[model samples]
Target chain A: MTDRQDRKAFFRELGKYSALGLEMALSVVIGMGIGYYLDRWLGTGPWLTIVWIGLGFAAGVRSLYRAAVRSGKDLERDEERRRKPGGP
Target chain B: MRKAILVLLAVAALPATALAAGGHGFSWFMMLPGGERLFYMYAAVFIAVFLLVAAAVVVGGKKTEEMVIPDPRFTLRNLFELILGFLQQLAEDIIGHHYKKYLPLLGTCFLFILFMNLIGLIPGFLPPTQKMNVTLGLALVIFLSTHYFGLRENGIAYLKHFLGPVWWMAPIMLPIEIISHLARPMSLSLRLFGNITGDHAVVAGFMALIPVVVPSVFMGLGVFVSFMQAFIFTVLSMIYISGAVTHAEEH
Candidate 1:
């Protein structure tokens, strides 16, 4: 592939990953927000929000961590392949 | 023809015995007790099934390699090859070139889900996909996998995709986009869970009440719904992955 095409492909892959990360982070925030508002309306004194939001945050972090670890592994694999003869 | 009629007569009498037995042959999983405990069972079942299938595939592939079977006439290996070939075609069609890299993840998700859905059709078995935890776990994997690809492709600049096109709209668009993004997993998980659960429940209820030829119609509907849910989940995942992999410049 030409440099421009390669760059485009790279960007496209980047966009995909970014969108996924954003989706996950947003899920947590919205989950927490909904819980918080519901608790407030129900006179639950922020307990529901606190707990749900915590869960949401935990879920988000877990997703992010997994993504990071997978990416790291992929990078290592690529590096190893590059070091070997006749690597792509 | 006379023997067939006699067999049909005996088959018709079987349900009476089954009904008289009581309990409907359903295990504890069907009870669906309150709280999130059901989620744990769902996760455990999903993981167990996944591991079992993975191991089977590995062992079966090795066994097939060692076998001296001459003809490729409809064996398990051939069946797997057919499935993998179809999945590869599907991946290429949906995701374009270099789709081989994604075949493992996407194919596994699709097949696992499809099998889980079909499992519900068995008399006593419950489809793990009918539960929220299983669907959620699959959604979580897709969600994370997309980001892993994104960050790997662009490093820190991957975050820029979330900022939107215009700088001013970032404030408003970010939250809206985020809400929609968050909804993807919820929608993915809940849509599969609700459809499968509802379909299975309807069939069970119908079988309980009518206990006759009527439940078959609902069972047909359940079958259709199960396939549709699997298709929807796979298509949506592809869409999400394609959207992530598409370059902002192209837009």
Candidate 2:
């Protein structure tokens, strides 16, 4: 039972981050989209576009970092649990 | 085995015959504007599922001596019970203790998306999920609800995470956070739309080329794709909502 539960948890965590690549790509696209619209609205040629695109790339990296941190913590917790007395 | 193959061939031929009869044109309903068509299809699917569930409830509730023994055969009530139980378990696992409040949203999303995808497998029906507008609309609902739950659960503290760890990093972190949040809906909708559309196209393409015993293989693959996509959408939505509502310090 414990073995099966571990497999289930493994799959759940796998599914959680399966779309990280797409999310990162869309972050950049959405950032550029927002930048383009803002430039049109305020008549600020290309400057805000550059700034927002950079922001979007930063956003993608941030999300990737967050996912890594989360999974790292999960691994640590799992290790701690496994090392406990009578743990499977 | 021979009889089963014959039936499968006949079922596969039905779509072609229907199209030929319709003069190779789409059904009247398909001619409606995209938004209107989506609305009508959703209403139709919603009502059909609601009626089926209501019937299942009524039938399953009947008092009987055999009720003491669990039914071995698959039944409508059993199907729903299985799905609900799965969702409940998923919520409890992901969202922790306060999971019940969100079950309604999660359950509806799973069932609705599953049925919507299954409908596309029929000879003449189109799945709304194959369209960007429909999937985006659903994704937006998830996005908005995540924020709503976050605000309700954590109040002012919810916005603190958006700001960042310290005062100096606010300017840099704020835009990144907003972009990340906006990307959630974009990613969700695009993934579902692309998967369904590609699956549908593959099935249709194979059906046109072979039109024999082979399309069934693709059709089987389509069913798996549909279920997998729905499951993925539900899993991601749960994770997002969990992230939103849970206290940041716990992470």
Top candidate on TM-score is 2
- CAPRI-style class, candidate 1: incorrect
Question: Candidate 1 chain B — worst ten consecutive residues by lDDT sum?
Answer: B17-26
- DockQ of all models, two decimals each: 0.11, 0.85
How large is the i-RMS for each model, in angstroms?
Answer: 8.5, 0.9
Instruction: Give the per-residue lDDT digits (tens) of candidate 1, residues B144-236.
Output: 897777677567777776767789977654544555557677767877788888888787777777665777798788787876677667666
Tens-place lDDT digits, model 2, residues A1-88? 2776587577668666877999899889989999999999999999999999999999998888877876787677677877889875
Candidate 2: pairs in clash: none
- TM-scores computed on chain B for all candidates: 0.78, 0.82
Instruction: Report the lDDT tens digits of candidate 2 across residue range B209-234.
Output: 76666777988999998988888899
lDDT of 1 at B144: 88
